[model samples]
Target: MRRGFLWDGFDAGIAAALAGDPDTARDHFERVLGEDPLAPGMVDAQEKTRELHALAADREAVAARVVHSCRSKPGLDPVRLAMS
Candidate 1:
């Protein structure tokens, strides 16, 4: 039997988020929310996806800052950050 379930979108969002594809995850989560914005749990999932994307962006920003810091500082290598 074929099914058109809302949770499918939610689950796909989680999987994409875990795979480091927050934009895809948000797209999925938003699709579910779009179906029923007032549905129980759907709102939460939407918020969670938004937060996850924000966090991912923040992490990338921090990493960029670290890389830039390493480049600007004298003889400080970001690769050494891994050794420490």
Candidate 2:
């Protein structure tokens, strides 16, 4: 099912994040959010999928904020931001 595909992406994202590969995790999470055929005929499944996508988006926003903060701070190691 389409919903299963979305869930697989979400799971992969979580695994990538836990493994410290933010780029890959972001890719998977974005795929989950982009796939729109998750629950073709079920409103409840669609709503749940939307909620999960929102959670992923919130996590993404937080990560972006952290990266931005790290990038703007003076004297911090550039390696922390993978800049060098």
Candidate 3:
């Protein structure tokens, strides 16, 4: 059930991102993060949404990256990725 919420938040975030609503996506993803910070793909979603929000194109591509990261993260995170 918890995982359901996780993915719900994740999917909502991705949908919002793809719809060109980074702020909404961030809000959804924030719920996911609050539920489980260590959940798979969350860090990437957070980071991607942050950067994606600043741009104006390729929202689908950005959302794809976030989904991919959520699918598989090789130890990357918002803070570390942000720093680099």
Candidate 4:
């Protein structure tokens, strides 16, 4: 399930970011992007994670934004929300 994989990667990325590991977060976000670049918040998550990795600033806020984007994308599947 591509959607499931994206969710997993996104979740892992958020966890990594919250743990103050931007490199790992970027890696997970990039993996999600690889799976589905156009999937909802994939691009934003990847870009934000990349910035977090490079700038190393405000990681918690970045992670929170990533989680919000992933959860709040318009027209997202209700089933996917349940899955997460």
Query: Which prediction has the highest TM-score against the true structure?
Result: 4
Candidate lDDT scores, in order, read 0.56, 0.54, 0.59, 0.61
Q: Which residue segments of model 4 deviate by more than 4 Å?
A: 1-4, 37-57, 63-84
Candidate 3 C-alpha RMSD relative to the actual structure:
8.4
lDDT (Cα, tens digit) per residue for candidate 4, span 1-84: 256467677677767777778778777766765664666566666666465555334465665555565566775543322221
Model 3 local distance difference test score: 0.59
Error of 4 at 64 (Å): 4.2
Please provide, for model 2 over 20-71, each residue's C-alpha lDDT reduced to its tens digit, 9 standing for 90 to 100: 6767767776677666654564444345434544444455543444455456
List TM-score per model, in order: 0.44, 0.43, 0.48, 0.50
Ranking 3 against 4 by lDDT, winner: 4
For residues 1-84, what per-residue lDDT tens digits would candidate 1 score against the true structure? 013466687667656655667777667756765664556666665565455445443435434443555476687555433211
In candidate 4 the C-alpha lDDT for residue 75 amounts to 50
Query: What are the per-residue Cα lDDT tens digits for candidate 3 across 1-84?
Result: 255456677677767777878778777766665664475576655565455444324575665566556556666453312211
